[model samples]
Target: MASNQASNNTQQESKFTLSMNHDMEQQQICLDHQQVEEKEFDYSKRSQWLRAAVLGANDGLVSTASLMMGIGAVKKDIKVMILTGFAGLVAGACSMAIGEFVSVYSQLDIEVAQMKRDNKRSNKIKGNNEDEKNVLPNPAQAAAASALAFSVGAIVPLLAASFIRDYKVRIGAVVAAVTIALMVFGWLGAVLGKAPAIKSSARVLFGGWLAMAITYGLTKLIGSSGL
Candidate 1:
């Protein structure tokens, strides 16, 4: 009778040990899943900033380069080209900054209003107001980021054309520089956004080329017509 009792106790202890192990394993799995979900959410949140920055840079590069090319079409002076590019860089940066600020401020206002309405609907539904507020966009930060990105991109063409004194060589240098920058920007945006690299690069390159061509052609036509 004592032997049987001892065996029964052993069996129960073994079962209890196995149960504890299973619970631990299940908890580990749950933790891993939660971590993965959080990582994905963080990545999605960061994508918005990446998209805005890439857009700002591309706009700055294309618009500034086009302006320089247009001016180069009319005037062969390197000084003139450089000056036009500098002016474009400053103006474009300011424009991008202001536009981003206004847009983001509007979005912030809307989000704040929505949050207020949601809070009024159900106190229990408000899980964490601090977390929600932390995720909200800052207009000033957006504006600064846009302005800095635009300035960085606009500098590319200015540096490329600065040293080349010959009109033809300067034009070629500007084109080459702009092409490379466009490809880099597109590839970067694609990689970050998980889009097709080839399509993104091709689209950006083609758009840049089109803008420069149109600007150059129009300016040349106008100058030639003495208008």
Candidate 2:
């Protein structure tokens, strides 16, 4: 009888041990799932900012380079080309900042309105919820980031043509530098957004080249025509 009792106790302990192990396994799975979800959310936020930066940089680089190329085609003076590029950089940066500010402000208003509606419908107090506030976009921050990115991109062509004295060489340098920067920006954007790197790079590179070519060709034609 005592032996039977001992065996029953052993069975109970074994079952308890199995149950604890199962619970632990379930907890581990839940934890891993939560971690994965958090990681993906973080990545999504990162991708958004990276994409914005890439767009701003690409705009700055292409516009400034095209302006320089156009001026070079007509004037052939390094000072004129540099000045044109600088003007374009400043104007583009300010434009980007203002545009981004307005766009994001509109978006922020829409989101805040939606959040307020949701809270009202759910009978929740409209408190200063940190989580809700954190998710909202800041117009000032967006504007600053956009301006900074545009300035950074616009400087590339300016620097590339700064030292070259020969008009032809300066144009070539600007083109080469803009091409490389476009490719890099495309690749970085693709990597962050999980897109095809080669395709993105090629598209950006060709677009930049086309813009510069068109600007140069048109300016040259106009200058030659004395129009």
Candidate 3:
């Protein structure tokens, strides 16, 4: 009987040990799941920085190329063309950085304000206990998007300048490239923003074409006026 009791005791101890091990395994699984969930949603700072850098480079390329091309169309010497391109590169980059910051800040401000207004409005309609949470964009995501957009917009022209030999060709290429990039970028932005891509693309293209027409018309005027 004592032997039988000892055997039962050993069996109970084994079962307890197994139960504890099972609980620990379950806890480990939960921890792993939580870690994955965090990773899936997290947008790293490096990603935003990289995006901003690319955008800046693209903008520098496109803007400098367009400016150089336009000036070259006026038959400016290489020295003058190079000077103008350099100036454009600096100015465009600064503009891109400032523009990105302002645009992002404004967007965020408006979003927050709108959310507050919405909450107030909802409260009036459905009472304070309706559990209406304000859904705002992830700050990191917004920063990444804005930085990437502006940097790319600026860098494209700068890179194009390296390939363009003549000022006029550079300008024309810059204009064409910028227009195309704007449309593509606009469409992408719209899609990301949950807007209709076709409408966004059309709007972006129209604006780009309009600007090009004006620039071209001005170039003609400069040529005709012998300026």
Candidate 4:
């Protein structure tokens, strides 16, 4: 009876050990699944759009504002400033759109060509199994984003100038408006890209100020020279 009891205990321990191991494996699998799901959830993936949009907007704000301010220094006429600003807005937007489209399309073409070469090389070898590589870049979408962003940035300074009468006041308003818009844009870009907002905002603001100041100074020098 004692020997039978010992055998029964041994069987029970074996069964318990197997059951515990099975439970542990199930728990491990569950944990792995959860980890994979969590990894797939990412908020920073929107940087692709933010990258192009922010750059376009920054260029629009700085370039259009600088142009108008340069002309404003020499000519205080509101119509001239408005006309110059409007022309810059249109030209800059078009340029940005075309440039972005071409650049993105060129990159896409190169990638496609490389992918084809890789596919050919892979097929020449025996018993090689590689995942198919496909890449598509939307040039139209990028162009549209750039154009729209440029218009948005350019309109702010123009609107500010339109409301003011004095050249000095207009210049001040344009500078202030561009600076604030740039700061906001930089902050928004930083937030979207998961970067430091303060640093980004400060850098963009300074760059914009320097651009407008330099342009205004040059125009003043030229004006004084009667050129």
Candidate 5:
């Protein structure tokens, strides 16, 4: 009977050890699964339009606001301010679209030309297939993106200062609206582009404020000079 009890104890201990090993394996598998689920972020995909989008919006906000502030400072007429703002918005949007299209198309053309040259040389040697399959930028897509972003951003100040009748109030409204919108744009750009948020926001905000101030100051000076 004593020997039988000892044998039973040995079997129980063996069973416990096996169970513990099984549980440990399961825990390790769970950890591996969790690690697989957490993936590193890839920024290459976002980089394509991230730059154009940020630039488009920044240009729209700054250009439109500066134009409005410059004109509004010298002349208090709402019509003049609105008309100038509208003109800037339209012209700026078109310019951005055209600029993006031309710029991207030119770059793509150059790259294609270079690739063709490379392919010719490569074919003369042993031939390379990698360059042929390289992805190039789409000019239409870039133009559309820039135009849309610029238009959206440009409208903020126009809409903000449109209703105000007071000259000073309208200018203030434009400045306030532009500064706030620029900060938001910067933050959005940073978040989407995976950059530092505060730095981006502050940089955009400062640029916009400086633009308005300079525009206002220059226009005021010119107005004071009576020419």
Candidate 6:
């Protein structure tokens, strides 16, 4: 009888241990799922800053180079060319900053307005609304993006002027730099904007080239007129 009682006690202990082990396994699975969800939601602000910095440096190099080239093409004096380059760098950086800020702010405003509209629509159609919250760009993200864009746009030209020597080479370098930067920016915009990469890249490139061309033509005409 004692042996039988001992066997029954052993069976109960085994069942209890098995149940505890199962619970532990279930808990571990839950923890893993939670970790994965957190990982999936992660976004890095530093990465955006790094991208902007690279873009800014590139912009600085290109714009300064282009201005120097255009001026050098007209004016043979090294002093005049350098001075013009310096001026262009400062002006370009400021222009880039302001332009970026304004453009980003405008977009941000539009997005906010859009989100508000969406919310109202969602409320009106409660049953039909299928988690539209995931579709909108976070406000924080837009702000970060804007800040990065402006910062990069402003800093590059200024730094480029400091490094480059030959006015014409600087100009060529600037053109190359700007072209590359535009391409990169386009890609970035497309990724962030969640749009077609090729289309976005083309748009950015076109705008950049148009600005450069206008500047080049105007400067040339003015230089030729002896003005």
Q: Backbone clashes per model, in order? A: 0, 0, 26, 0, 0, 6
Worst 10-residue lDDT window, candidate 1: 122-131
Deviation from native of the Cα of residue 109 in model 6, angstroms: 2.3
What TM-score against the true fold does each predicted structure earn?
0.85, 0.89, 0.48, 0.79, 0.76, 0.47
Name model 5 segments beyond 4 Å from true: 1-41, 121-134
116-167 per-residue lDDT for model 2 (tens digits): 8887788675465557898799999999999999999999999999999987
Local distance difference test scores for all models: 0.95, 0.92, 0.63, 0.88, 0.87, 0.65
Model 3 off-target regions past 4 Å? 44-50, 69-76, 111-227
Error of 1 at 170 (Å): 0.6
1-227 per-residue lDDT for model 3 (tens digits): 99999999999999999999999999999999999877654535344444455445445544555565566666557667667777776666556656766776787788767767877776554543243334443455554455445555656655555576776676666677777777776676565455688887787667556654665567767987976
Whichever of 1 and 2 has more lDDT, that candidate is: 1
- RMSD per candidate (Å) reads 2.9, 2.1, 9.6, 4.6, 5.7, 8.4
Give lDDT tens digits, candidate 6, residues 7-121.
9999999999999999999999999999987655543544555455545544654566556656766775667766776676567666656665666667667876886787786
Q: Candidate 6, after superposition: displacement of residue 37 in Å?
A: 3.8
Worst 10 contiguous positions by lDDT, candidate 4? 126-135
- CA lDDT of 178 in candidate 3? 72
Query: Clashing residue pairs, candidate 6?
Result: 56-156, 60-156, 60-157, 62-174, 65-170, 65-171
Position 219, candidate 2: lDDT: 92
Considering TM-score, which of the candidate structures 3 and 6 is the better prediction for this target?
3
Full ranking by TM-score: 2, 1, 4, 5, 3, 6
Residue by residue across 1-227, what tens digits does model 1's lDDT show?
A: 99999999999999999999999999999999999999899779879889888999999999999999999999999999999999999999999999999999999999999999888887734458877999899999999999999998999999999999988999999999999999999999998888899999999999999999999999999999999
User: If the candidates were sorted by their lDDT against the true structure, best first, what order would they fall in?
Assistant: 1, 2, 4, 5, 6, 3
Q: Cα lDDT of model 6 overall?
A: 0.65
lDDT of 4 by residue, 104-206 (tens): 8997789778867876877644333233332367788888999999999999889999978887889889988998999999999998777899999999999
List candidate 1 stretches off by more than 4 Å: 1-10, 123-135
Best by TM-score: 2
* Comparison by lDDT, 2 against 3, better one: 2
